[model samples]
Target chain A: MPKPMLKRSVQQTQTNNVLSVTGNQKQNNQNQQMNKMKIDKLLRQKRSKEYMDALHKLDVGGHVHNQNKVDEITNAIKREFPEVEISGILLGYVSICYLGKPYEVHTLDIASGIIEHYKSGETLPNGMEKARGIALHGGYEFIEVYVDCCRAVSSNGTVSVISI
Target chain B: MSDRVISQANLSYIERNLSAIHGEIQALENDVDAVNNNVKVVYDQVGVLANEFHEFVYEQKKANRLGQAEIKLVQIRQELEKKYGHYDIVRRTTTGILQADDLGIVKKTTISNATEELMISTPNYWLAPCLVALSAWISDQPELAEKALREGIKRNDEKTSLFFAIICMRANRKSACLKWAQRYLANQDEENLDRKAIIVIDAYANGLMGADTEGVISREMTKWLEELAEKPGFVEQQTTQWTEAINLKREPIENSGYTYLPKYSNTWPVLEDILEGANLHANILAYLMDIFEQESSSAPIKAQLDKILTSLVTDFDDEELPLRKKEKFEQFVVEFCGDEDRARQSMAIEETAFETHKDFTQLLTDAAMKPESSHASVATQKFAIALSKEWILNAYNDVIAQNRMKIPTEIEINVDTFNSKTTDGQNEAQLVNEFTQLVTKEKEAALAKNVLTGFDKFLLIGGAIIAVLGVGMIFGNPLGGFIAVIAGIGMVIKHFNKKKQLVINEENIKKNYEQKLENGLQIIRAILAEVVDFRIEFAEKDDESAKVVDFLEQITPDQYVKNLSTSNRRIKM
Candidate 1:
């Protein structure tokens, strides 16, 4: 009876050892697969446009626009705001302000153009016109355009294009 | 029966023991497997960490390389900016010359060219910084100017001398200015020999020292003007044209059938001639203004000049001359009024105070009206002609005077004194003869003295070959004698080889030095381009971080390889 009991205990111990070893191996394999997934996720996050935009926003105050697009937008602005000083445009665009007034509409139009041009490859040749047309089409033509543009600053200090 | 009982018990005991040992062994094996797995995990982590570290290092190095390259690019750009900026100054100086020349002030040509060349050929290291300093100097930023000038000197830049001279002059450091001027004069090539640079230097030095340098400056100015005047068809042709125009008679002489002279025919040409003559006169007047303003001026002399000016203006309205002559007369009046002092004074007056200087204003108004005279029909006919003549004559005289003083008739050197004091053996007689010859020949002086010295050094090396031949002859062996004979012949060949080599080396040195300077200048230009681009890009960007990163990425490689390759081709002789 003693011998049989001893043998039974030994067998139970061996089985336990094998089970532990197999369990640990399985856990390790799972951990590796999870880590790989996490790395892939991080890489995808890094490469995303949203991530790049966030990085850019942190660095410079304004959104980036191609030189040609900027010229077109400025030209449109000039046509709309003929009475406005050209110096005002440069300062407003660069500092995003115009004589103590926020340049939200101008900033937003520039941002929308950047996104349209870079991400969707959509051409916004007449960004100012489209913006004005949209506002007019929406029955906001009676609004003072320059003043409205000035009042569209967001909480993040970025100017919004819809007001223009 | 007893043996069977004992064996069964032993078997049972052995079996139980074996099972326990087997269990222990399995546990140990599992432990080992766990340890192995942990090691694998550690190894994998370590490998990833190592790779990341390596990449970080590589990235750092890349960034550093980029930074270094950017720095180099900036340096080059700065150099080029200096060079081109100086070139711009040179261009402006050239433009000034052209303006002066077109106005018939050709005496300013040499000085203008020298100034231009000095600006263009300035070494990169000095050019940019010096230009910045110059701009600063112009803007009255003394500290910045000094910093720039010091930096230029530190770089051993050629522009250092020019900048040093300019700064010294500006700072009223007479001794320093003179030192630099003398050095410049000594180094000046033949083309630089009648250049205004020396005159400018002298004037600046003298002004700083409070020395009366007027006599010297006036003399040089006169000489240059005289030379210009001597040029055929300069003033005479214009005078003739004016004479012919004024000589034109309105009425024809009633002659017996065959008329020898046409009366009205001479009138038109005479009027045209007067108009032409007036223009030449205006040029001379303009030249005088430039000289008087630039050379030196005292308040008293400047004041006395006012009276002389008034007389010239009053004479313009003298109605005794013919219509054409009157027109020419009015031109001379306007030309006289165009003098720098008169213009400056006139311009200095407030518009509201036009009544205060009624006499001056009336004179100007009268001259202006003469140009619009109905009788002449041609606007500014008299004033234009006279102004041109005056400006041309003044310029010609000033140039002639300036040249006479600046050009040295003889360069004296004490051979014993120079040789004893300096390492260079001063061959005074030879130097003096050469100096005299150079003044006459002009062409030979254009080549640098270093080139000539290099040629002489090569000849000396050639002569030393005989020593080698003599050595071979000292040996008694027949083979040595044969070698000596061959060596003597070889010495002669070597002499020719060395002479050719010396010329080639000197040429190469000059060429290489110029190339290095050009490369350095090009690098500076590249930097300026980057700065311009950066400014444009930054202006366009809304995100500061993105702009910064973009700018960082825009760093260009700055690797300038100065070629110092010495060709090893032996002489065929």
Candidate 2:
């Protein structure tokens, strides 16, 4: 019983509604993409304790020049922070080198190695050598190794509380 | 024909019905009183428990038992956390009892709802909103707290408005609070009791905002002192009492006759100790010298001012400091002005100033430490001593007034204006007697002002309904017009009666307000006199340190005229 113009108007409204719904879907997809990008950027910028520890281990591993030992530590880091995507890895003279996500990584296995050295009642320098091994194997350029309560070993081989 | 048909019984029936309604209203009033009492008792009990908890924590800390203190704190936090409601709705008794600072220990987002249900049935009571706002502030959610304050302000009551203004001031929204206070004062009657209270409150807020309080404070002090001079032995007694109290390291014994001591002595040793410190004196010197520097002059005062200023700049070299360090110094100044914990660093600046002005510094210190041995000149020194005490006491009162202004609770709002009428014969007198007992015990006159009028609307509505019923009867049958006429007359009579009672009630409240104002003024004067007495005694003891006084008098810069004469002599040479 509706007029022809009225019927056309109703049809036009339905079509517009469908278009708007698609538009909303597209907007939501863009938002999700933006959020993912933001998260990725933040992850890249963040320099956490794990990253510092990883760097320390890498520097110590370079000093020791043990390729197999360094490779094992890198594999351990790969399993720990799975969110980090690795780019490349290489073993060079006087250093077990690699390239990957600019983020920190340390595993339970690496932590236990440091803890065991402490359990043996060794001096801090001896325990730090264990931390250096993990850092070298992990190929971390900037890292920190937790030695004991309120103390940590940095890539510089300095044992102190975190201030900056 | 309708008038002729009017019956005496109809009129009697209307009167009887009206009487019954009055009885019901009285009963409702009694019920409200009982409920108010119950709420008060609960609040009092909670207050006691809170005090006990505070004492327990204090004891634990005093013993250096951190572990026990931590446990106790956690237990308190857990209890508050359990009763937490929605973030926006602060309508919970437990929320009121929970201190805002303690709420910081709990997780944010614990509360889930904006409760529409009022915590207390008392109209215009803002206890819940204040609690919620404080809790939100402690949680670092200022926006949410501000929203709660806005809601509290909607009550449109003077005490509530004043409370909000204080909160705003605390939040560092100084200009906003000032504007609100100005508007509040503007709206009040010139002679309103609340106006005087608001004036003191606003003045205090102004001081906190770093406004110069010297002008208003001087006027108030002069007025109070003049009034105090009339009271025999009052000033001398207060001075002795406060001096003794200070020596004993205890609060001054309150003499009921000297009621103003509390208000006047609010600043107590706090401001005096600050003035004694090197920093505040340096700041005052800096402020004074800065003023003279702006006004070009050839005088010894100007010369001395220039020396102090130049030394400060060269020694500190504060201008050349890095931007961040300069910012830190500015922050220190702000803290010092606020009298906050961080202001300790600002006080250090005073020590630096003292090093520069060693003689002046030593003089003040010696005067405070040394005793007066000038017994021969004691009578001569009395006037100077009293004058000096008055000046110092007024200055101290200024600081106290400003500090008290920062905390709104320091100023008490009088809410005892609500009183029952004696217009309803025996019933009216009985009601008045009942309310006097109830109100004195509960002390919630503002709440009474709001809830007590609830029955008036019902009475109005009942009278209208009776008239309507009479109209309905007449519309159905012409012979029933007499019933309608009687009902109409009854409605008019009741309406006039209620209106007259309202007018009388308003007059009574107005009279009470005037009386309370006078009483408030008297207390404030008493407070000023108390401090004057205490400071005078302290100055009397220091009067014996004549060497320092003589040194200060000789060394202090002479007038510009004298300096100009010296300059003329030099030019002649």
Provide chain B TM-scores across all predictions. Answer: 0.19, 0.20
List DockQ for all candidates: 0.00, 0.00
Q: Highest TM-score, which number? A: 2
- Residues B410-482 of candidate 2 have per-residue lDDT tens digits of 1221223433322112243344445455544443363246332545555566667766777777867756765
Displacement of the residue B37 alpha carbon in candidate 2, Å: 61
Cα lDDT tens digits for candidate 1, B13-104? 99999999999999999999999999999999999999999988876765565555445545554654543444344435434432443355
**Model 2 clash tally, residue pairs:** 21
Identify the runs in model 1 with alpha carbons over 4 angstroms from their true place: A1-164, B1-172, B190-267, B286-573
lDDT of 1 by residue, A34-110 (tens): 65444322211112233223322321334344555455544554553344353322222211111122222223233
Q: Kindly provide the TM-score obtained by chain B of candidate 1 when compared with the true chain B.
A: 0.19
DockQ of candidate 2 (2 decimals): 0.00
How much lDDT does candidate 2 score?
0.39
Q: After superposition, how far is residue B391 of candidate 1 from its true place, in Å?
A: 14
Docking class of 2: incorrect
